[model samples]
Target: MSGFITALFDPTMPFVRNAALAGFLSSILFGILGSVVTVKRIAGLAGAISHAVLGGIGMALFLSVRGIVPGLPPIVGALIFAVIAAALIGVVSLKAKQREDTVINAIWAIGMSLGVLFIAKTPGYADPMSYMFGNILLVGGRELVLLAILDLVAIALVLAFYPQIEASAFDEEFATTRGVPVQAVFLAILTVTAVAVVLLQTFVGIVMVIAMLTLPAGTAGYVARNLAGMMVGATVLSWLFSFAGLALSWELDLPTGALVVTIAGAAFLGVAAVRGLKALAKRAGRRAEGRVAGQEAGR
Candidate 1:
C-alpha cells in the first residue's frame, strides 16, 4: 500500500498531476465567468459560444490536416475563429433589432452546422468525440500557460468593472441613464464570455461547457444574496465538483467531462430542493399564523 501511494505521488506521474492542476485552475476561472453569465441572463449566449467553438475547431483541424497552415497551432486557429464568431454574434444581435434569443438561436444553429460540415469534409482530422467531450489528460505546459493568462485577465476584468457590471446586469436602461456606457459594457462582457468559453472548450468540450459555466453559479445564486457572495460560493462549489469529478473519473475510468457535469448537475438539484423546501415551510408558517389570528378575532 505504501509503495502504491508513493508511486501515485511521484513526480514521474506526469499526466495525472498536471491534469489535476489544470482542472482546478479551469474550474475557478469558469465559475467566475459563469456567475456573470447567469446574472446577465446570457447563459444561452454562453452556450451558443461554446457550441460555436466546434466550428472553429473543425476549421483549424481542416487547415492543419491540409497543411495549409502547417506552422500554425490548431488551438491558435480555433481561438481566432471563435473570437471572430463571438464578434459577429455581437454585431448581428445589435443590428438585427429582433429578440436576442431569436438572434442567438440562429447563430448557434449556423455555427454548429458549419462545424459538423467542416469536420465531415476534412480528411485525417481526429475523432470529433474528443472535441465534443474534451481531453484533459492531454493538457501540456503551453495550455497551462494560456489558461493562466486568460484566468488573470478574467479576474482583473471582474474586479475592475464590478460596479458597472452590477448596474448593467440588474438594469441596463438605468445603467445607461447613469452614464455607465451600457453598450460598451455589454460588448466587453460578451467578449470575455467568448474567450472563457473557448478556454473551457479545451477542457470540457462544447457539449458539457454550459454545465460547467452555469450549474455551480445557479446553485450558488440560491443561497447568495449579493454578487460577491455568489461569486465566492460558486467558485468554491465549482472547485469541489471539479476535483471530486476528476478523482472519481480516475478511480472508475469514466469520462472526465461527463463526471464533472454530472456532479455539478447533482449540486444544482440539491440546492433547488433545499430552496423549495424552505419556501414551502415559509408558506405553511404564514397559513398557520393567519388561521390563529382569525380564531382569536372570532373569540
Candidate 2:
C-alpha cells in the first residue's frame, strides 16, 4: 500500500496515477449507468455486450497485423461491436417477437468464441487474459481521458433525461402511454451502456466488468429510495472498491481487476446477507407475536 502510494508520486510510474484516475472517473459511469441497468433489470443484456466486445477486440488485432485496417486500436473494434450488439438486443427486446435471452446468449457465446479464435490466429500469440482480466498498470493516459469524457457524458445524459429515464426504468409500458418514446429511450440507454462497457473493459476486463457494474448499484439498492439516490450511492461505493482494489492489489501483488471485482462482490454479498438476516428476524418476531395474540384471544 505504501509502495503504491509512493509510486503514485514517483513520476517514473505514471500508469499508477492513471489507474487511480481510471477508478475515479469510471465510478461515475458504474454508478449512473449501473443504477439504470439494475432498475431496468438489464444486467444480462449488459453482460452480453461486455463479453461480445472481445470479438471486436480480436478482430481489430487480427486486422491490424494483416494490414487490413492496419494500426486499428482494439478499443475501436470493441466500441463498434458493443454498440451493434446493444442495438440488436434492444431491437429484438423491443419487438418481443422472440425470446430475448436466446439472442443475448447467442451473442455472448459467439462474441467470446470469435475473440478466442481471432487471438489464436493472430500473427503471434495474443494473450486473451489481459482483455479478459485487465492489468491496471497498462491503463494509459488516453484511456483515463476517455473515462473522464464518458463520465461527463453519462452524467449529462442522465440529468437531461432524468424524468423520462426514471419513468421508463421503473415501468416502460407506463412511460410509453405517457408518450415518452419508450423504445427510443430504451435504445439510447443500451447504446450508452455499450459505450461504457467498452471503456470499463479496460478497467476490469470483459468478464469482471459486469460485476463492478451490478454490485455497487445492487448494494446501493439497500439504501437508495430512488434512481438518483442509487446513482449517487453506487458511484461512491464503486470508487471506494476501485481505489481499495488498486491499493491492496498493489500491496499484495495480486491481479488488480480481479481484486477489484472480488472487493465489490464481497461488499454486495455482505450487504445482502445482512439485509436477509434482518428480514428473517423480523418475520420470526411477527410470527411469535401472532401466536401470542392468538393464544390471548382464545383465553
Candidate 3:
C-alpha cells in the first residue's frame, strides 16, 4: 500500500501519471458514449467497430515499416479505419435493415484479416499480443493528448444533440415526426462512437474493448433513472473499476488491460447476481402473500 501510494505521488514516474490520466479520460468517453450505445441497442455494432480497428493498426505499422507513410502514426490509421467502419455500419444499419449483421460481420472479419496480413508481411517482430490484449502502461504523452481531444469532441457533440439523440434512441417515429433529423443524428452518434472505440482500444485492445464499453454502462443502467444519470453512474463505476484494476496490476505484476476488463466483468456479474436474487426473493414474497390471501378467504 505504501509503495503504491508512493508510485502515484512520485513525480519521477511519468508513466503512472499517464496511466491515471488515461483511465480518467477513457472513463469519461466510455461513460457517455457507452450509455448512448446501450440505450440505442447498438452493442453489437460497437463490437464490430472495436474489432475493425485492428485493420488500421496493422496498416499503419506496415506503412511505417515500408517508408510509404513514415510520419503516419498507428493511431491515425486506427482512427481512419474506425471512422470508415462506423460510417459504413451506420449506413448499412440505416438502409440495409435486413442484412446489417451480415455486412458488419464481414467488415469485422476482413479488417482483422487485413491486419494480420499486413503484420505478417512487415519486416521484423510486431507483437500482436500488445495490440490484441493491450498495455495501458505503454500509453504515452501523445496518446494522452489524443484521448483528451476525443473526450472534448465527444462531450461537445453529445451535449449539442442530446435531445435529438434521446428522441431518436427512444422513439424514431416520434423523433422523425418532431423533425429531429434522425438519420443525421444517428450517424453522428456512430461516428463519435467509432472514434471513442479506437481511442479506448489503446487501453483494453481490440478483443476486450466491447466488454469495457458495455459492462459498466450496463451495470449503471440498473440504477440510473435517465440517460444523463446513466452516464454519470457509468463514469463513476468505470473509474472505480479502472483504478482498482490498475492498482491490482501493479501489486500483482499482471497485465493492466486484462486486469481492468476482469475487474469490470466481476463487478458486472456481481451486480447481476444481486439483482437476480432480489427478483427471486420478491417473487417468493408475492407467492406467500397470495397463499395467505387465499387462506383468509377460505376462513
Best by TM-score: 2
Q: How many clashing pairs per prediction, in order?
A: 0, 0, 0
For candidate 3, lDDT tens digit of each residue in 1-299? 45766898899998887887888888988898889999999888988888888889999999999999897788888988898899889888988879998988988898888889989988889977788888777789888898899889988887888888889999999999999998988888888788778888966687657876799999999889999999889988888888888888888888888888889999989999999999999999999999999999999
Predicted structure 3: lDDT: 0.86
Question: Which portions of model 3 miss their true places by more than 4 Å?
Answer: none
**TM-scores for every predicted model:** 0.92, 0.97, 0.95
Q: Which sequence of candidate numbers ranks them by TM-score, best first?
A: 2, 3, 1
Worst 10 residues of 2 by lDDT: 200-209
Full candidate order by lDDT, most accurate first: 2, 3, 1
> Clash pairs of candidate 3?
none
Off by over 4 Å in 2: none
Error of 1 at 120 (Å): 1.5
| Cα lDDT, model 2, residue 242 | 92
For residues 1-299, could you state the per-residue lDDT of candidate 1 as single tens digits?
34434544778877776677787778777678888889988888887777777778777777777788765555665677668767877887677646667767767787777778878888864677887889777878877888888888878988999999999999999998999998798898888888777877876687667887899899999989988778888888888887787777777778988898899999899889989999999999999999999999999
Best by lDDT: 2
What is the per-residue lDDT of model 2 for residues 75-173, given as tens digits with 9 covering 90 to 100?
A: 899988998899889888988737899999999999999999999889977898889997767888888888888888998999899999999988888
